[model samples]
Target chain A: MKAEAGCRACRGSCCGNPLVAELRGIPCNRRILLVGNPNVGKSVLFTRLTGVHAISSNYPGTTVGFSEGRLAFGNSCFHLIDVPGAYTLDPTNEAEDVARRIVDEGAEAVIVVLDSTALERNLYLALQVLERGLPVVVALNMVDEARHKGIAVDASALAEALGVPVVPTVAVTGQGINELVRALEERTRRAAPEAHSPAETTPPATLRSAEERWLVIGSVIQRVQRVTHRHHTWRDKLEDASVDRIWGGLIALAVILGSYSAIRLLGEGLIDHLLDPLANRLLLPLLEKLSAALGGEGLLHHILIGRLVDGAIDFEQSFGMLTTGLYVEFVMVLPYVTAFYTVLSFLEDFGYLPRLAVFFDALLHRLGLHGFAIIPTLLGLGCNVPGILATRVLESPRERFIAATLISVAVPCAGLQAMAVGVLGDLGGRYVLIPYAVLAVSWVILGRILHLVLPGYSPELIVEIPPYRLPSPSGLLLKLWFRIKGFLLEATPLVLGGVLLVNLLTMAGIVQAAARLTAPLFQGVLGLPPEAAGPLLLGILRKDVAVGMLVPLGLSPQQLVVAVVTLAMTFPCIATFIVLWRELGGRRLAASMGIMFFTAFAAGGLLHALFSLVGR
Target chain B: MGRQSSNFNPEQENLFRRTDSEEEALSNPAASEPPHPRQEAGGLRCPLRDVPNGRRVRVVSLPRGESGARLEALGIRPGKIVTKLSGMPFSGPVALELDGRQIAVGHGVSRAILVEEVPEP
Candidate 1:
């Protein structure tokens, strides 16, 4: 009954018991977990084994939580769970806490993924897991990289040292995966008899401390790993230069400028040459026929084709579920999303982000955050959902709150950025920079304020700066595909629904009344028309659609800047709001929203006053 | 592991010398005792922050708290050899190499990690 209850609760997704599987008419699965240190390519190994793509990166903490998938081999199936990377089982942070809990909860077998390049340090964790008495198959991952660095790890020696099977693997390619699976099969099969004899593997009454573990690990490493002198390659030079005090700063600046140019060039090219023509030549004609078939002016036509502006469909201004919704999501936003992720994924896979974090540490500390917060903030620029989720990598609750709040309020997602550019770019290139400038100022001011007000000290940066491996083209494309797929799935329906809701509200006369009620705030304080209220309201659901709504309002470029800035500072889109709540909980979420409202209004009013004084 | 007491520079030693009470306040009982014997024997000892870039040093002791434990977990424990690679100005993080891996430790954390220079082999 208890198993059935759990089965029902999870909808049979996580239930691994044979009886429960039989009752549900599904084959029983053996639970095998993959565990490793940060940046050890465990996620890649998980993907290889299960054929499920988990977002793998060159930096640490890419996976802040676990992901589950099923791997079928020979006859039996494996419910493979990729646990968050941990340096040790003795929990030092949240990720390690999750890892420790999962290991304690028990699995049919565990696969301890060891980085071949860092064998001595990696062995500390492997030994900890072995002391827990779990049946573990050691996956010596990244063997090729180790060899490239002139570090050789003897797999049989390592296995013999630990009394476990060690399979060397290069996860990026498919090398050694088949052998890994076979070794896993052999280990798990032998686990049956081993599980019955707890006395043999259970840790001693006097558990070893960290220093003691290191002592044992040192002996083990001496026998298994050999490091020889190697010539200094270009990669070594680049790595040194990247972290050099003067050179690191210069390189960081170059990276920022280069990334901006690349994103703009690629995004604009895609829109002009590809998506825009497709929408006009292919979709516009099809929509026109649908409009005419609907008798040119009805509820369906208004909702679907929207109002024809002077007998032509205006994709930007149309408040139709089909017209603006599809256009904004696919044409206006998707290209920018694609371009941004392409650049970000490359940086992630190239192992450059951690070095950037190092360069920014001193500056970030002034705002009560350490350098690692930049990862989440950078991610927020892509989309706030994962950005907020990545806050789990921060050590303290205070840091997570500050980081999440700052991300939601100051960091505009790619969708919002795309629409802002679309609306403001026509005014002038300079006009496009206004909202970004204001957002950057607000980010610093708000971060300082939060740091002053929040209790508890933020932990210092203790991140591993991974070696600069040339990013694999296939890995880059795969990661980009996963992010783009996520964007399409989460944004498509929301954009359509937001448009339909706007139409329905307009049809019911609610928009006019709401706009009227907010007239003084929009007209007097923010220097915008009363109709700006509608888009601001829509901004809560989808910021891109909200910015799109502003195009039809015909505000001046100054007012457009004011509106865009306010919209960005206000409530994040529904998806981000939900994630923030889940991450920050009710009390902190409320505090975060309160800050959002205050900042949005104050910034909007101040910008309005400044523009008015300047006579722009 | 050989001692090189003659390498001590009195001027540099004065830069890092701390009051006995301050050392006591920062020390954790659970960790090993302060490396006073090395200091008294005239070896050059200082916080990790004071170490010059590209110098190899052995960790002496860590501060008392989570950061120290975390540093240890990341292979910066006492008796380990680490090379100070780069340190940013304005109290930024110090990038160091341990066991052929690069690690960045923040300003406050670096200040609490005590290290002594290792004479070239």
Candidate 2:
């Protein structure tokens, strides 16, 4: 998948589904690609056109973020693909390659979404699209922002000049979206007739020289755009400060630490003020009543509501498919996942991520990864699957392996962290932080080792730092909704299934045999209990639930901390493992897992010795 | 993003480091000979990487192929005036302003690109 990610359409293995290369298939749908420069609201326009929920980020590259939506207009449905934004069709990057492929692969009509404010530069890409001789329409988007910047674009003049329909649109507000759709339908209909016409009538023009294209663009911009204001605004000041030497560093730090603290605070508060009271106080009593009503002892009661702690419900330790599973998933993990993605949504839309990536490029380079490599690692904090998939943004395989290995082995996703915090936070905040410290140190160490061993070149970063924007509240909420919804949709069943599997394993006595098999190693090297064996095995299925399993073992704070770090380091979850397999292929996946296991055991043993020596 | 061309392989750097003395002897047969440094970037033609930050330069030539063609299409061809912006201190991407937009190019492509420094007001 990693090899093919760059040229997926070129690989003719799956000819049955033409749309497979772009995104998911939409049955009986003609293709309509949303192509434009980065951060130009192409994804927002995609959502507005199709009402398909593809949350757009304001950052330059989001690794696995193309969407195919079913758009029905006037008894015709088309698959609207939101390809990654590119500056030009000449591919400078992987995303750009995907964009060029989608356009070159013969879409019915291509909608060139251009920023009205940056018309001159946007015209470079737009003119290239026009020269392709495909049915085309230009969506002169962000006109409202352009107007705020004292710029007004004449859509009619642009339409007449380009010889295609141009719809002036504010994609975020859905302004002129209907008109844009109407224009698209009419233009696409006009395309079929034009295709049959003489080649001389609308011949594919020779590729224009850069100077010639700029000359044409200059005249077009002069004709259509009217600049009313010459003075700089607060937005300009903010943009400058956000990238300034001292202030930019400070701002980047503030953005990272501030958002991190904000997420943690929000998640803890939700669990405390909302989810916990509902779970422990309200739901616990009711669930206990149900357990009692089911006679409270046999397989049904055990599977549904595991053994209670002192006749009271303990969500983490209960080990039930229903009781603890629901609480751990909804009450514990969901809050952190919700809060992290909420803040991430704001950062993405604020266009702060790329700037942050730029700011950290040099530092990341020392760690054997590109500056843009930070995106995948950071995204992995939200969830490892998408984070691993996001490695597609990196060009080469070695960088992906290094980033993926570090992420899987060190970075704990929100689910895992939430569980770690919930369990460890009870002991002390200091104790709760120990695993993260271990991971942070491990990130640099493992990265250096991987750099030494990995047999390929790491790609360098060449990314655009998108101009910053003040995120609209509605846009923030919409993005947050999509992320939270995705988490709920994906994690709920997996949590349930993981819990069911663990419980089934215990019932079959497989866990005992596994525990006895690993007991010598766990007890002697790690100074951990044999019961630690079960959670470590299940950690491969779901790290969050596995961490929850630690609560029942009644280990010391230091022991629990060691166990948490071990679990996080051992392996990515089954879903993430599959994605890693797809991305790194079979051989690389096996190598990484080998590294993961060796690291986990060695780290666990080292921590045990450290704890013993320090008497923690 | 840059014109990598698969020129640099990962194993070469480590292998070169391990056999550094042997390679030096092989390349320069006379161990006692006074080494004379070659004058590269001697005159008007220099790679973009060697250009100091804040220096405005005109694009002179780019490597031929898809990357070159694409770079040209984006208004970053010969005779276009561009200003080098902030370059990350290490061997990182060099930022340039061209066609009135800031673009970051990786060091590899910057090395491939030849530029002539120009004075700007």
Candidate 3:
């Protein structure tokens, strides 16, 4: 059945207008439909309601549709269907179309989940839904936050005016859950209506036009809402200034820089104190014993077990199962990955990001992008996979290419940065600043260049600034678990495999041959020893291993900075390459990869020549 | 009715509390009287723009500005009244709405408009 639809923004684009296609039948038993704006609380609510037995997520453009499950409310069982979120009934993106389809077809009832703080923005969509005339219940979620912000509403008055139940809820905490169930039960108890619904509840004579609806909304808000408080605290004022003014950008930058330093310091220290010991003292010993008992000598020993001629854990190279992958995955990489995600999540949960977007907006605009691009760029620091995927939030393909290129080139993934600090930190604590400076300058300069070359208008810097609060510990920790688990599953395997592959390539004499061929450029242009070629080539696998190998060569601080920059700008690691290929498409991917190779060499050569001229 | 995409993750309780219905539904009953859904308040209501200078009257409905398309979709249509929820000390965003939905407009956007508070029912 066609649902009531009236969104002022869309102006009858949803159910308020005529349908372009024929109405379809609802052939299923459980008639549940999901609703909300994109990136609000829909998916989380869907997951919580449906459990783990459904198609929770899917790749974009895929033909696979909504997921369904059964939910029991009181004495009744209903089918719960999770559709995509849309701004209004108006479908702009692929996800919106999915939501549109569900509503156009029949559903028993629709629950409109509105974000509490951004109520005005959300209500635009709600109005469209209410116009459809389906059984409607307003799930007034996030009530606690509204009160905290000194905003109050009158639900009873709202229900009375709208002619539907209004349920206040904190879905995450499951507050008002029983009431929601009762409301749903009340909605379902009514006899099934005729298959299709009328376009409007009343004839055109009595129907309210767009102007009348706003007038009605205004009057209802006036009657129901009471302002109990008049003043905001100082902290809220500071945030308003930071997000609203030109100076806001600078403040955001300072906050981001402070966050980065804090994360690095805390993450590195925690790994050193707790995780490193567990890996070294416990996991490594167990793995070594397991491998030995499996096979200590012979050919099976050669590939899998490795030879243990002496008592020194003797292995030809670190690539054997016992030697490389196991160590890299469990020991060298896991501690740092765990630490990185925990810190990253804390900042995200604290709501410091959108403010940073304000700061980055101008700079990004210069680079033919907008401030929101910073989100993916920041994510790139952890791993390029999600970073590339997140570029979907950007508007155009050209922006995506530039963002991907900049991220792959200038942004240092956790593994690379950790390795850089680990390798050169002991030589001089001050050396850490060099990579940061180089990256900062390169990103700025490269972004400027890309802006001049790329085509498209950078989107505006409009962002929602969530009020600051102490993050929920349980929620934050759960978020951390998801992030860290993704790292362990995706990055750890690559690091392990990359380390072993490099080790095997070196052992097989291929790396030596490659290094020999690049010896002249390595020595004459980059001013590094020819042996550095092997690790630089191997850097694509996992950056830390490349840096670890560099320890044996003993490069000076100046040389270290150049080497690190070159390594970072060179080909992205195997994982990132996969993402780049997916995001950039075949042609652009190849082009960017080619540019990266040349840039790495050219920049390193230029820096080397300059440094030598200055008597370094 | 058109369905709202339940896409938001309200993992934190506060995020869900700020919506119009939730804010009104969850208010402390002791602070004021229990809600009367359909009454038109005729008592003095504070106009946010007028503040101390303006006369108090019950909110009747939202005034539709030139951007006719968007405000309508926002559930900000007529017949419902609004009260000035809060004008923060620093004069940033002001929260107000029609029906149960809320809107927090920046000071610049809010100042251009006028509001008349309706008396309590």
Q: Top model by TM-score, which number?
A: 1
lDDT of 1 by residue, A131-201 (tens): 77778888898899999999999998877778778899898897888888888778766635264323332
Give candidates' CA RMSD values in order.
6.5, 7.6, 12.3
Model 3 spans > 4 angstroms off: A1-33, A38-40, A51-86, A91-109, A132-135, A185-216, A244-254, A283-332, A513-541, A549-560, B1-121
A352: Cα error in model 1, Å: 0.6
Worst 10 residues of 2 chain A by lDDT: A1-10
lDDT digits (tens) for residues A1-616 of candidate 2:
1112223343343222333444434321277778888778898888777665676777766524577755555545566778888888877666788888777776788889998877877888888887787777889998988887788888988887787788999998888887887887787666362743332223465677666777787788888888885676776656656544466678888988999899989998998899988887788888989998988778887888988788766777788987989988999899999899988878878877776776777667656677777778888999998888888777666778888888888888999999888888888889877788888888878887776565544555556566667888987887788788888888888889888888889999999999999999889989889989999889888889999888888899889988999998997898899999998999989999999989888888898999999986
DockQ of 3: 0.04
Docking tier of model 3: it is incorrect
Pairwise lDDT winner, candidates 1 and 3: 1
Model 1 ranges with Cα > 4 A deviation:
A1-29, A191-206, B1-25, B28-31, B34-42
Stretches > 4 Å off in candidate 2:
A1-29, A63-65, A150-152, A191-229, B1-121
The fraction of reference interface contacts (C-alpha pairs within 8 A across chains A and B) present in each candidate is 0.62, 0.22, 0.04
Report the C-alpha lDDT of model 2 over B1-121, residue by residue, as the tens digit. Answer: 2322222334353322322112321342212322222212324767787888668887766644444554554557666688776565544567676633556665555665677766566
Of candidates 3 and 2, the better by TM-score: 2
Q: What is the CAPRI rating of model 1's predicted complex?
A: acceptable
